[model samples]
Target: MGKWTNLIKQTTDSDPISGAVNTPIQLSSTFSQADFDTYGHFDYSRSGNPTRESGERTLASLEGGKYGYLFSTGMAAISSVLFIFSSGDHLVVSKQVYGGTFRILHDVLPRFGITYDLVDFSNIEEIKKAIKPNTKALYIETPANPTLNITDISAVVALAKEQGLLTIADNTFMTPLTQRPLELGVDIVVHSATKFLAGHSDILAGVAVTNDDELAKRIYFIQNAVGATLGVTDTWLLLRGLKTLGVRYKRSSESAQTIAEHLQADKRVVQVLYPGLSSHKGYDIHQRQASSGGAVLSFDVGSLENARKVVEHLEIPIFSVSLGAVESIISYPPKMSHAELNSEELLEVGITPGLLRLSVGLEDVEDLIDDLDQALSYID
Candidate 1:
């Protein structure tokens, strides 16, 4: 219960009826009531289910939060949080967030009268300048998407408190093991559970955890109203994935550090963006907040031609989109994750064609390095 491995392993409450070690999935859509006057803990599956409840409780416990809500997808969970704010309410968001998140804030939310200003959260002063009277929240992704940039959580939380603004952080990269935003005073934490949380890349789920009871109440209402609750089967699958996160993330991160160092030494790579490297600009601040550098890293291969050659020729990692899988994944952000952004928007966020993001898996470091070396050799 105290450590991460224990936290994940013991998430399921044992079945009292069957004496089973794991929590059994309650797949029924409705539960029979004991009497006419009293309703059971659950009524309809959309509002709540036993399997989803167990997973939610575990997620909340892991993040040191009081409540957790499950969603069918990461965006659904994030959208639920956004729905809490009304029209004319504004938000300050990190500039380099996931492309889907960017699209929602930039393209979708504006239609509903909600507005956001994307700012470089790495610079605390810049964040201060971006805040306005209408700003209701600050949404950020630390170890930001594609770029791997780090933002100081505690500092931002302090500023948000002073301004009476709620703080939400996407903790998908670090997971609860490496970084817990709630512990650092963030109001809410969101995760794309398909990543490290599920490990196997099999489930598409999202979770939001919060320490504030009031916020949790509002979030749960939105989740039920939107009807995006995670199904019983996926919840069970996600639970299975959570059990191995500690070991998988540790091994992957170790390999990623080795690969990042190897790539940094090569003349073909202009830059390796991993907080584990001391050369990374956010290394010191990252070390202060997170327990490890995490398993995801990105590098600049100098040009679009070199980047494409390296990804297409790589034999080990899948040169595909999405990350934090048991198998290594290499992605071209400009075309895949951030594809919605046009050339101008891409440049503003620092996503370039030369940049390739790698999510190191539980593969041997030497093998990964060799695969990368061979792929890069073809670039010249």
Candidate 2:
């Protein structure tokens, strides 16, 4: 079946009892055991729930993986994955990773005796230089948060394989619709399903998928042990949201390309960072790996003052933190998404004070453009 067809069909599961089109949410915390010796498929909600399991299986099928796990939030999924490694194991991480992931690596993981080296993933040689003998995995976020930097997934995976290290990728920005990193040889693929997969900003969720049986077992163990699994209600909502992902992503991406071009041509904009723009450093590579430029773009307006002026004056996109919604959102990295990083650390990753990340939505392209024009007029 085609991807779009599979998207809708895979997410739609009929209720066995009522034959309802939507997957039924099983809210029971515990199920009756037929016998003490033999438990049913799901004995406890924390270990597994019908709704969450259905969603997880669907996600695995979509990402072309053998196993899938869902969590209460994106961070929980990521943190659970990190728990797979033993104490003293090291990792090679993308420098432009999301703030929460960075916090995990910088603040949380170190206390567990896990060390990581931040490297510019665009430069494969830098990644090689950063890898130590203890490095067990390579972590990356292609079209990374805020900056939208692209990393060659296949290239990184190949390098990791040569060194006998696992390759983990955060596929939140591109999602499976645009780029399936697992298909590109990534060991595991993770997503903040709260964004594109859910399509609406109404839920907080995370997903992880893997093809390796052993890795899947480890992740499931961590998920069951940690008990941060997604609630049945949120799982049902996420499934409903997945049905419309194709349409939502297509419309948003088309609008994002138009907006990126508009921002690129504007004199008030210092630089536009979007893979859709050919002028972008990683445009060619991105085209090779992904289907679209995605629905997010970032631009620099010269200084923090200019950024604030444009953000405050913007009447269309709301000034907010999260992205991938029916409504457009504009966020300042220095204060919002990447706020955990200090000034020097942010600049080192090219997250300047003037930079503003915009998540394009379902609004009329012309109307969004007009709104942006009016906002930029206040910049100068």
Relative to the true structure, candidate 2 has a C-alpha RMSD (angstroms) of 0.7
Check candidate 1 and list the clashing pairs: none
Tens digits of per-residue lDDT, candidate 1, 1-380, equal 45665665666578889988788989899999989999899999999999999999999988888899999999899988998999999999999999989889988899889999999999989999999999999997999999999999999999999999999999999999999899999999999998999989898999999989899999999998989999999999988888888889999999998999999999989889999999999999999999899999999998899898998899999988889999999999999999999999888988877999999999889999999999999878
Candidate topping TM-score: 2
Q: For residues 166-241, could you state the per-residue lDDT of candidate 2 as single tens digits? A: 9999999998989989999999999999999997899999999999999999999999999999999999999999
Q: Where in model 2 is the C-alpha error above 4 Å?
A: none
- The superposed Cα distance between candidate 1 and the true structure at residue 252, in angstroms, equals 0.4
State residue 190's C-alpha deviation in candidate 1, in Å.
Answer: 0.2
Instruction: Report the Cα lDDT for residue 246, model 1.
Output: 85
